[model samples]
Target: METVAQRQIHSLLAKYGESHLNHTNELIHFICIPAIVFSFLGMIWALHPLAAIAVTVVSLLYYFRLSVPFALGMLLMSGAMLWMLSVLSQDQVLKVSLAVFVVAWIGQFIGHKIEGKKPSFFDDLRFLLIGPLFVLSFLYRRFHIAY
Candidate 1:
């Protein structure tokens, strides 16, 4: 039987998958979404390292409830992104992250234009969080890991 969390994850992924039907759009997301996540982490890290750490902890807990393998993968990726963020000077983190965030969003809009669909987040904010998981689901599939 599917656990409640697994069922929820699958449902959310299916909803998220709808607007990402175009191959070019999916390809853009495969690159831009991670960049957006990294930049968001960096921006949070700039405010306070603790704030960034807190987000990571909460996010991992949420992911853990949904899928253990995905949570682990996200944990590793989060660690690396945090490490990269930590190395930048405080001012540099803000500037660099802002630049990346803007560029990544531009890429997202372009992809959506090609897809001819409004972003899922416009209809529901939680899709913002679901986007990264959508990308990770692809990785999980390639590895034959049940998520």
Candidate 2:
């Protein structure tokens, strides 16, 4: 019996074609996204500590249907972003990280566009939270963590 997270991921893979994501490539995304968000936050007014907290809470609240594994991944990544931004230099790290995130998300958009399917999250915002977790699921499997 598939769990709800399993079902959602399955639906996405079915629509997008499993070929859309190479396992290693997706894991790279899992690692990189938080770094990008961290860097981007340093350069933006809305990226204050309070706002970051709000983003995490709001996104997680929207992710109830997802799963423990998926939720854990989100918490981990968001925490990582907060740490990286706090430690790194705003002028240098922020610019580079922002660029990387923009490029990666663009790739994601392109992937969905090629599938001729709108992003699942666009249908319901919680799926936006699922996008990164879908990437981390590969890492979880690689480590035998049971995501």
Candidate with top TM-score is 1
Per-model tally of clashing residue pairs: 0, 0
Summed over model 1, clashes come to 0
Kindly list the per-residue Cα lDDT of model 2 for residues 1-147, writing each as its tens digit.
898777876676444334334554444445554544554554441345566677667766655455666677777877776676666664565466667667767765665555555556565664544556666666787899764
Candidate 1 residue pairs that clash: none
> In model 2, which range of ten residues has the least summed lDDT?
13-22
Q: lDDT scores for all predictions?
A: 0.93, 0.59
Q: Which candidate is the best by lDDT?
A: 1
TM-score of every candidate: 0.96, 0.62
TM value for model 1: 0.96
Q: Residue 89: error of model 1 in Å?
A: 2.3
Cα distance off (Å), candidate 1, residue 43: 0.9
